[model samples]
Target: MKRFLWILFLGVTFSSTAQRMVLKKGRVLDSIPVAHNATDNFGLYLPKNYDASQKWPVVFVCDMKGDGLNVLENYKTSAEKQGYIFISINNLTDTLSISKNVLIANRIIVGASAIFSINPSRVYVAGFEEGARFASILPVFIGNVDGVISCGSDIGSIEILDAKNPFHYIGIVGKGDFNYTNMLQTENVLNKLKFPNQLLTFEGGHDWPPAKKLEEALEIFSLSSMVKGNNPKDKSFIEASYNASWERINSLIYSLKMLEAEDLITQTESVYPRLVGLDSLKEKLRQLKKNKIYKTQKRDENAAFNKESLTRVDYAYYLEEDVNTYNFKNLGWWSYQMDELKKHSASPNAIESQMGERLMGFLNALIQENIGTLKKEDPIDEEGLRFLWMLKTITAPKEYSNYLKVISSSAKNDDFGTALFYTEELLKKGYTNKSELYDLKDTALLRITPEFNELVAQYLKGARYELPIE
Candidate 1:
């Protein structure tokens, strides 16, 4: 691995004075301390065409790592294109109580509105992954929020969705993402409840969709406003939006993306009645619904779900037993199960492949929820943590922190060989934190050894520490 310099900047606090927020247009204000607390900082972005005299929609975003700037970057382009104010707190974590983060979000909302012309009727929340779940639940508690734009995840709790006060929901998920099924289920529930919603599917997994996808989500909100007469509906704007959506639906059908095509057709069917180009859209939708490919795909989807349920039940039982007994011997069994899932994901049968992706996603969610519960024990469950870290290493190899945890646990138990092995693995994953490599907890003995130093030198070239460098 090549040496990479990582710079971490501290959030700049703004005093709560009488002056309005002095902000530049079109650039992310990396951090703005909410309530003058460093830990309460949020990223803010204003459209280049922003006008203080006119009200604009404002979106509050969240990320699990409190990486406000990073999440905002994924959203700013779409926000700028749509002319919305955006803000996100960099202090939320899944381990923290949701109420605590809600308070942080509320503070930013109130603070931003005080200084900007944020339209209360258009207040929305958006987030990715765990943050997406957090955003989904906010409209229930925060009455000011009008809707939610959830990416890569679904609602934290469907119980919180109030039918009487239904808010708009725009779910953007990837077909290969673990939460794809969750989003699909959410769409049905939302539709059944008469909630205005749309589920947009792309082509990848467990990651943010492209900027254009984000723009489509914002467009949903914009279109909704026009329908409700909150914003004046210009005929041209409505036609352009309708034509754009029609083109996307047509493209999905032509590319054999039957599921995505069906979703878009359903969406436009429900929505086009109120917009321009309804006749043409209805004809296109009619043809799509009658297509042989569409019928076959829907049947296959149902079959896949039934098969996946059986497989999930079997795996769930063994995984629960393994966790209950701390069965290290079953680690190989778990590994095999994971491999099977990967294989199915690559299968030629499209339905089987989708089911595989959903199952993998389900497993990851199960382990994560278990880990969250286990961590809240009075005295932390080290053994449980170790088990989860090991599971995460296999299930989510891209997550380097779990590997670090395993290395730490091994070092604490004086398992130098295991610790060194993970260190090498972590470095192989392209981790560049040389400082933390030596400073890893309970690794004093292992960090000084030639084997560890040699491994470090292989990655971080000039590192030839005969003795502990520190």
Candidate 2:
């Protein structure tokens, strides 16, 4: 008689006690159980060229909501481009304690290694926002992770950074992301620590980088591996990457992104010396800086950044006071401030435009922090939540969900005027979910009111429950 063991891979389960489970390559497996007895599932992807015979780099991704499949999808193309495996944990929700979430990520790491051909020298972690913060901290707790691709957030705790075992850190952030300044600051800190790191910026706000940028970040990982002798250096790849970097800098110079381009060249200067024939790159960089236009641009950018910083400080101070004192009367003043930021964002001056967006982005992060604190109150601070939510609707006006939150919170307080105002605001933002409006908790009486129904009918064409106006 022979002993038997079960192994599942890609919708197929095999019975073999002698061998570990082997997953199919090339496509995403939406839910692969950690083990038959385990409660959590993980999303996984293997390159089409993957073979059990060859060890491959693996990246573990985390989504705050535990949506492993969706998060894994973002890395699919990048994995294929870089010859890596991608896996995402499905049980690491924000509601869980940080310790628990870290443990969950570690379990997935161990479980995936057991089932796949993972390279011990090249394991990485990546995630967005809360997930990104979790990824940034994991290497501190788990020794196996060699690098992190943190998107839209910085490391949650600076105390955990181990100087002796610094990992390769790639931070991807949007120009308009709330985490933009933090990511830049993190990059500077990593530079001083002599840690291998790169900060990639895109053109949006507080979201995952596009697939192309993810691939670029992964390429940086591959290049770092080659530079460190973890992987054999290919002359063709080295030359292509170096040339691409030069081309980007040149493009930036042509487009009046002198400061950004100078920063990029400076950031990569240490790494490029490893590639042959790139010694002249530094000279080219010096020449770029000496250009009269570059000097002028740098001066203008400094002025804008400094002015924006002072304005942001003022906004932060008053917003906190307003939220704490429930100064609803100051709401009009906040509205005017948002409008001014928007106007600057649309200004013809590049520095002013960028500073404006950054100011707005910073405000979003500040308000969100206040909101998180209010929600964590033992008895629940409804007034604080309402104030922050109202501010959020003005600052992040495009976010329809904030408008919805305001409506629900206002209705709970029986502030029908506030509720009705936000109901119209939500609709104006193109929120057409009639059922969602009807289903909102604590909104029963408010939704049935003639004012609420009339607004709903005006925007969405009809309301589930309407009251006739006299």
Top TM-score prediction, candidate number: 2
Query: What value of lDDT does candidate 2 attain over all alpha carbons?
Result: 0.82
Best by lDDT: 2
Per-residue lDDT of candidate 1, residues 33-89 (tens digit): 555455666788888888777989988887887687876777788899888888876
What is candidate 2's lDDT per residue for 1-470, written digit by digit as tens? Answer: 32222465432222322335545667787767665324667888878887778889998888887676876776688889888899888888888899999888888888889877788889999999889999999999999888999999998887778789999899999877757777888988988887888888887777899987888778888878887888888999878877888898889888978877886787567556576665677787889889998899888887976787788789889988898799988989989999999998898887777778888888888898888888788998888788888888888888888888888888888888988988888888888889988999889999778878888888999877756757
Quality of model 1 by C-alpha lDDT:
0.81
Which pairs clash (backbone N, Cα, C closer than 3 Å) in model 1?
none
Candidate 2 residue 149 C-alpha distance from true site, Å:
0.9
Instruction: Report how far off residue 300 is in candidate 2 (Å).
Output: 2.3
- TM-scores across all candidates? 0.83, 0.89
